[model samples]
Target: MSWARIMAPLSGGEGDATALAAAVRLAEPFGAEVAGVYTPADVADVMPWMGEGFLGGVQTTALESLKEAAAAGEAKAREAMSHVTYGKNAFVSLQTPVWSGLSAESRLSDVIVFNGDSARGRGPLAEAFQQMVADEQRPVLVARGEFSVGGPIAVAWDGGKEASRAARLALPLLEKASRVVILAAPKASSRTFDPTRLQAYYAARGVTAEIDILPDSGDAAPLLLYAAGKVGAEILVAGAFGHPRLQEFIFGGTTRSLLAAEAPTLFLSH
Candidate 1:
């Protein structure tokens, strides 16, 4: 498996630069195209609030304001993308139906990239991040501080479908890592499984991986994080387990803990 294209959603905010830089780093090794997509606010979404009885002048002014905001955002996104000179790059500006445009772009790409702000639900692209992982079910890379693709990588295994999917989707990346380690805590969960299954799977794909059976702990996130740090892993591959609950996405305990942590880039799939 190979990654041919990477999609990075840019909100023209503080996280845009980090997210774009991470995408470029991931793309360089695979010779993949890095698409910096500018996500703009859809004017149509606000039109309903104007009410049917609103005056024409008021509506026109509101529309103009929205257009101006979008233009400024697009300019900022372009500026952020301009710094990427390492690999193939493209600048994409979403249309009126911004969400649909983003979804389409994500479907066509191999993986989606987001910054720490988006991953922590603290920025303009937070909702977009949730939608991609939960609704779109696409592979996503949450780029944290100083993300590097040349370092060691750790894979969290739970013998679940989600983990299996994540491992499969992350094959291309794992194949390129300096070292790959599989971290599993079978005694922590009710499910009985072996981590060597994953090791064999990776071996079949020509990737050598070491297995680490963590001590039984009530919570698996801490163990996984500790092991990843011990191994000096630059990235942790795991399945994002979450479902939409009304307005928010409720993530599984381990997934939540990992997302809330401050270090190690996350490569996740739902």
Candidate 2:
């Protein structure tokens, strides 16, 4: 499928540009419209409340400060949007109550792009990433670090629906890649597609790919990432694998616990 409209949520965080960069890079080959969305905190929600007394001057001052903070975030987001203008269709939107606003916007867009900093308790960005992955179940582009994005894509295949879904969403990038490597974890329990079959599938699409079975290491996810990196891949496409349990996949379930600078930009679909 082609990505005609891409929505990137820019928090103006430590590595927000990675998502913006991925969206812009993908847009060039597909001519997609990139929208840089900013979701700021709600001032009212963070304001202090009295049990049964009227508001005082202190509370009023605190409310104004929170409003200014939110406004400042929006301003920074607007400024960040200026750095990316490759397709002549880049735009920005500052949203409120981050999670709900972004989730709603994601429904209207083809893909949601965000920084892959999914550590628990980090902030709203992490929470939004989890909600979208677990609740929304949409295709997400998690920018782990700086990446070429359009070149040398690696598909972390497990023969499951999630894996195939990720591959499908990543088709535009894969087609444009100088090389595509199908990385498989044979030990993965829920596999469905075989490398030979996947190879033929890509062959029909006029894309040549090399299939390599990763060793049955103790941990499959990190090893899979390791193999993809070894192949000089710039992007790693994988399914957003998740199950209802405390323990999750190596690449992190919807929580994105596995993101790191060393890892390539991830194109994940569940």
Candidate 3:
């Protein structure tokens, strides 16, 4: 059986309810479970720094805001579940860093759903998003405009451990795809593609695969994006490059451009 999970960032800008709703729809057929996450509002000022007379007011305001946010999250979670089609089965839960302890648990999920914004909890631009993908070693799907996830899929492969991992992770969805394009791109080290070997890999798994080889260009992101769109790919799955220590590689040029691109990306990092 196939399973999927969507991580709603829970913020006014990036990880909000809209993305969660779309994630719910995407997970409908798979009967996936979804989790909502929100960063609690800052209350340190009210706790020890405020005057005794004003402390009560500050505490009340903070509590009210927290309640509102929690209520909104619950309502959105309910709404997301309402759109499910495959027997309308989905389990929803809310978690946080200090209280609900969701932050620790997100590392264990298979897939995380995040937004492009920087300030919305641990989103695509945040370190948590990268950790969720590369460090925690899971696939992260970033939500963008129009939220169309199911369609033609593009698989970026270099025959490395990372590329193979991405291909394997994408197998479930690839089997469901009407068309699957296997893209072999240029990388630094000595890497070659054995069409026969790859064909056997897919053949063994019952996937009739179509392959293409592209030149090693300076920027792989745009090239991959262009190729996917040309093939009418709605969901693009690729092995994410860049070392976790190098900020330039993680949140810098290539990653930013790819995440900012029009297509919804399923990223697996090495």
CA lDDT, every prediction? Answer: 0.89, 0.71, 0.61
Candidates 1 and 3 compared: the better one by lDDT is 1
lDDT (Cα) of model 1 = 0.89
Model 1 spans with C-alpha error above 4 angstroms = 53-59, 242-252
Clashes of each: 0, 2, 2
**In model 2, what are the clashing residue pairs, if there are any?**
159-192, 159-193
Model 2, residue 206: displacement in angstroms? 3.1
**207 Cα displacement, candidate 2 (Å):** 2.7
How many angstroms is residue 185 displaced in model 3 relative to the true structure, after the best TM-score fit?
1.8
Q: How high is the lDDT of residue 249 in model 3?
A: 51
Please provide, for model 3 over 1-270, each residue's C-alpha lDDT reduced to its tens digit, 9 standing for 90 to 100.
275565544433324555566566566657666655554333442345555665476667876786686666556555554544445334444443332344555655556666555412344236556556656666766665554545678887767676677788777677777888887665522666664566568778887778766666867777778788788877777766543446745556455567666565454555
Q: What does candidate 1's lDDT look like per residue over 127-199, in tens digits?
A: 9998998889999999988867767999998888778899999999998889999999998877888899999
Give the TM-score comparing model 1 with the true structure, all chains together.
0.93
The order of the candidates by TM-score, greatest first, is 1, 2, 3
Q: Which candidate ranks first by lDDT, i.e. highest?
A: 1
What are the candidates' C-alpha RMSDs?
Answer: 2.0, 3.3, 4.8
Clashes of 1: 0
lDDT assessment of candidate 2: 0.71
lDDT of model 1 at residue 30?
Answer: 89
